[model samples]
Each structure stands twice: as structure tokens, then as C-alpha cells.
Target: MYMILKSMKKNKLRNLVIVVQLIFGIVILSNSLANYKYYISTREKAENASSSNVYEVSVENKADIFKVGEARDHQYISGEENQISTVYKIAKESKLVEKIGFEGLGCNSCQYTNEEENEGKFILKSKIKTIGIVEYSKELTEMYNFKMKSGMNFSQYYKSEKAEDVIPMLISPQLSKDNPIGSIVKLPGGGKKYKVIGVLDNSCPLLNELYNMGCLYKPNNGYFCVIGSLLTNKKTHLYIKLKDGVSKAEGKNDFDKKLGEKFETQFFGLDDMAETVTLPAPYAARYILFGIIILVLSSFGIINTVLSTILKRKKEFGTRIAVGATKAQIEKLVIGEFIIFFAFSAFIGLIIAKLISGQQAVWDFSVIGISIGIVFLILVISMIPAYFRMRKMNPVDLVHGR
Candidate 1:
């Protein structure tokens, strides 16, 4: 046993390869485990934004449902929607609905009106070219907890005719990082300036973040306003938080279709996977596959190395048998040496895996343990081949190198 240690020390390259292979295997397994945890967490978090027996929908109706909150009289196109509005107004007056809210949607595209300022600078997004309708929903804001990081939320003054209705804005994390917040962004049409308000939850749409970050850009007019027109605001989406006992998942197809017809548009069920994490899943899967492949390759290398060591020391094994070593003793010596090698390899691999994982989203100790366990299994399996090769050796002939 001491001779094995001395031999390993003498053959530094061989030992180094074994250690390296172990480390690689552990790192891959740890990363795979980390990724699995991230996806699971995401699923859980997305589920929380809904109530029990509730579902989420993203509506895109060309008809105007969201009304712009301006410091003046509200106006609507005298169309069939007005008829529905009268009915909804009556329904609300009768307390038939538990709650109601409206959010105005708007976007603006800006061209190189200020090319000198932006020509060389790397803008996170195109300059705003179009601006869409702005709406206010007290209930929507309260429940979503979408507070402005800077400036003020819509107050009573915004509802007054004398008050100059100002457009409150917010942005995404990406845009804010690219362009500092609290800066004024130029609009395409009127060259109106909208100040950065706050960055919303990271889960918020990047487009919304862009607006808050002042990185919003349009190629055409600086401002565009449209409310209750789902077809017009294609870029914007809606979120509905159901009250207790709401059943959008059940026999509400007729109701949903009616709403769809009233809005003159299609509604889509928005799944959580569609909303969060810009990181592509293919990359995660590729990492897992790569780790698995590396682990497999390392297992092959380790098994080969162990078997070669046992085979090379055949003469010593034969001598031990001739000196009254029982078959059990021989097997113990063989198995013990390999078990130690594998255990040592596993220890080193775990350390490497931990360092690489850091404090980010994924790989951990469990991954290392599983990986090492697999290595142990491979080691045992490989012993069978080595056993057959060396089992029939006659001590005398083995010692004489015949």
C-alpha cells in the first residue's frame, strides 16, 4: 500500500490526470444540478402571481378598453364599443362586478433627430419612434406594487383639467444598466421629454424597463396614444389577477369568447415560461449534456487507469498469493486500493465544483456526491474486466514474468 503511494508520487503525470478527470466530472454534475434548481424556482415564483384556481391571460384587442387619463374630458369613438361601455357602466352601477381597472398602452419610435448625441453612443434600444396611450388603474398599480422609483404616481392632480397631465414612466433592468435612470429621453413626434421614473421587477417586460430606463426609442412620431384598441397596441400585453374563486380555467370559454368578440381580437393564455429569463434553454441543456458527456469520459479514463495499475502490479499480487495470502485477502487489497482512489478523487472534485458554483443560481454538493457515486459504480464495473484478465495467473509463472 505504501509502495502504491510512492509509485503514484513518482508518476506525477498519471496522478495529475486522475485528479483532473475527477475535478472535471464534479464540476459538470454540480452545474447540471444548479440549472435544475433554477428552472424549478422559476416555475414556483411564476405560480405565485396567481390565486388558487386562477389563470392568466394576455389580451390583444383592437377595440379600445383602456381609457387614457388626461387632465380634460374623456372622449371615445362613437362606435359599437360605446354600446358595450353603457352596459358595463350599468353593470358596475349595479355592483355586479367585484372590481375593475384599466391600463393605457402607448409606444413611440424616434429616428436620428439627435443623431449627433446618439450616433457614436451604444444605445440599448432604438430611439423611441412611437408613443402609445397612457392609462391609470389604481387597483392594478396597488396589487402589482408597481411604484415609481423616481417622480410621482398618478394623483388627484392628474385627474384635474387644470393640472398638466404628465406621463409617468418606468424602465427595465437591462435598459437602466445600459442607460442611467432619471435622464430625459426625447420623443419622436413632439420632441416631448419623458423622464425615467423607476425600474420595475426584473420579471417585468424588457420593453417596460426600456420606458423606465429612458432607453425607449421610436423611428417615427415621438408620441402615439391609443386606448381600448388592442389591435393598435400590439407590442403591449395585459395581466389579470383573479379575485378569490375566479375560474378562468373552467367553463368560461363562452365568456372568454364573448370578451374576445367585444374587443374584436384574440386572447392568449400567457404561461410563465414565456415571460421570464432571456437565457435560452438550449444553452442550459447543452451545458447538462456536456457535463454528462465529460463525466462519462472521465469515468472511462479513471476505470482504465485503475485497471492498468492493478494489472501492472501483477508480479506483486502473485508473490502475495504464494506467501499464503487468501483469495479474500487479494480481493480486499484490490478493492480497497481502488475505493481509496475513487474516494480521494471525489473529494478533490467536490472542492472544484464548489469554487466554480460560487453564489450564483446553480451546482452544489449533492451534484458532486451523485457524480462520485457514479464513478464508484464505474470503478466496480471495470474491476470485472481486470479480474478476468488477471484471475487465472499462476503465482510461479506470474512472478517469473511468463
Candidate 2:
């Protein structure tokens, strides 16, 4: 160990180059693995959503008008009857429709202020930054597999009609830090109050789904409130699950025939919707390719450096061998020096990569295992040329400068 440290100090410039290469290689590889893992996770979630056999229906009122030159030309001219409500009713009555739900953009201008009881007076806390809101049905919650952090999901509130005075709402994990379960949050001047019946899990599928559909800018920073009743005045989208043995095409055709020319409707399956949302396969593949290329180049550079170092130290190694050191000892000494360099490089590289990726610095077992495997492989491959040279060493010839 002392000799290894001394040698490293002596070859400071060379060792520094190797360390830099190792660090760069490790960082690239680590981030690539992370990206691949994330892609797989996202695809799995999308597949799960697809397995639910849910489809989204976008509706457009035929009576609405649009002009080429006018700003905000798409004026929503209200018809005598609510076309969306009629579509919902028609879907509800259809034999092919198993479950149906509707959702719409909630009040974007609304603000949520938490009221805290101080002594005998009520004080308003700071207003929470509301990103956006979605007015959805309990059926949509079931369709998206939304889990709750605390309290009951929308199903309980929707069926039992609990907390009749205040509107039942579910806030995201980001909002739950300030507002706990059963907390009353009011929309200032909106003349409506909301009761936090549930706090959604951090990994809410509904939020992810909505984000895919461009409904929410940020998935974590949003709120979900149960729709009191479906109305055509509000622009809404429908989530419909067809009965078993019924294809999506069949369902779309049936709905189209029923609605006729009054409303424009487009249906999207979960799989198709997910394709637009999740990371593409090629994107993740590019990372993996770049990582592998870096790893190979780094390995080759290290091997060349190791071979050069061995060539230069032949006389020193020969002297040691003549005195007492065995071939195995010399090999162990060289490999040990690299092991130290690699271990240090890996530690720094992982920290740097985590910072760059904006992810937590927590090292999981899989990451640790991969790091170990990489170090081991690089160590073995880089030391091969040095090992062969050391084995063929002739102490007399080496010392005599042969």
C-alpha cells in the first residue's frame, strides 16, 4: 500500500489523467442507467393504464364558431340544450359502456387560503400557489388507479355524499405539506369552500395521465375536486370504459352514430395516449449507446496507460522480483493502485451525476452493484497487458538494461 501510494505520487500527471477518464466514464454510464430505468418505469405505468381499457373522448360543440382573422375567434355560442350532457346521458344509457366519467378544467383564477385558529379569532395563512385544478368524477379515479396518502379516495365521498356542506377535494402531495386531511380550504371570493377529504399519493396516475393530455402543466402542483354534476356549459372531456369483448373502434363507431352531426368527438385509448407522453425508446437507447462508447474508450485508454507504466517500471519490478517479491505480488501491487483510483473516481462521479440529474443522492443496491461490476471489469481488462509483461520479466536482463 505504501509503495502504491509512492508510485501514484511519482506518476502524478499520468495518474491524474486516468482518474479524470474514469470519472467521466462513470458519470456517463451512471446517468445512462438511470435514464434507462426511468424509461422502463414510465412504460410500465403506461401499460398498466392501458390494461384498464379506458378511453378518452374529446368533444367539440358544432354550434361554436371560429374565424381566421379574429383574436379568440372560437366563440362558444351556447346552444339551447347542453350537447355534452346529452352525450354523457347517451353513453350512460348505452349497453356497451361499462363505466363513464367526465373531467374539465377547474377555476384557474381561484386561490386557496388556509385558515388557522389563533386564540378565539380565525387567521388566514399564506395563500398556496395553485398550479391548476381538474374537476373529475369518482369513476375517473378508479380508471386511473389513483392512490391516496391519507383519508378515503373519491369513491367514498361520491357514493356516500359525506361532508355535504363543503365540496370534497383531493390535493396533491405537494399541497399536503400545508393542508392535512380534513382541512377546510376556501376559494377566496369564489363563494365555494372545499374539504380536503384525501391527500393523493406522490405517484398519482391521474396526475400523470392529465399531464400527458396537456391538462396540467406540472403534475405535482395541482388539485382534484369531484364534479358536483356534469354540465354542458363547462368544456369537459369524457373517460369511457367499454364492456368486455367490445373493441375501441366499435365503441367509437357506436358513439359517432348516436351523436350524429351535432357534436364532434374523438376517442383516444390509454395506450395511444401513453405513447405521446412517455419517453421514446430511441431516446433512452441513445444514452445507453453513448455510455457504452465512453466506457469502451476509457477502458482502452486505461489499458494503454497501464501498459506504458509497466514498460517504464520494468527495471524496478525486476529488482523487486530478484530480492523477494513474487510475480503475483507485483500484479497485486499494480491492480491495488488502480482499485484505489477507480473507487475514488466512482464515488466522485456518482455524486456529480446525481447533482447533474437533479435526483436524490441515495444509492440503491442496484446502483451500487453496477458500480462494483464496472470497476471490477475495468480493473481486470486494464491489468491484462501489465500482467503478461510482468510474468515474462527477466531480473538479470532487466537490471542490465537488456
Q: Flag regions of model 2 displaced more than 4 Å.
A: 49-51, 59-94, 108-128, 159-163, 207-233, 258-265, 359-364, 399-401
Clashes of each: 46, 0
lDDT of each: 0.47, 0.63
lDDT of 2 at 277: 48
Cα RMSD of predicted structure 2 = 5.3
TM-score of each: 0.50, 0.78
The stretch of ten residues in a row with the least summed lDDT in candidate 1 is 225-234
lDDT of each residue in 1-402, candidate 1, tens digit only: 764565457658876776677667656665656655555444444444322332223323354454433111243424334533533343244322344444444443334456534633432243353333343344334333333334333332134324232344455444555445545554343434444455545332222322222222321332322112221322233334444554444323423444444432222222433244323345656776676676567666756776777677777766777778765666666566556666787777666666676343445456556666666666677567656655665667755645
- Model 2 clashing residue pairs (backbone): none
- lDDT: worst 10-residue window of model 2: 116-125
Name the candidate that leads on TM-score.
2
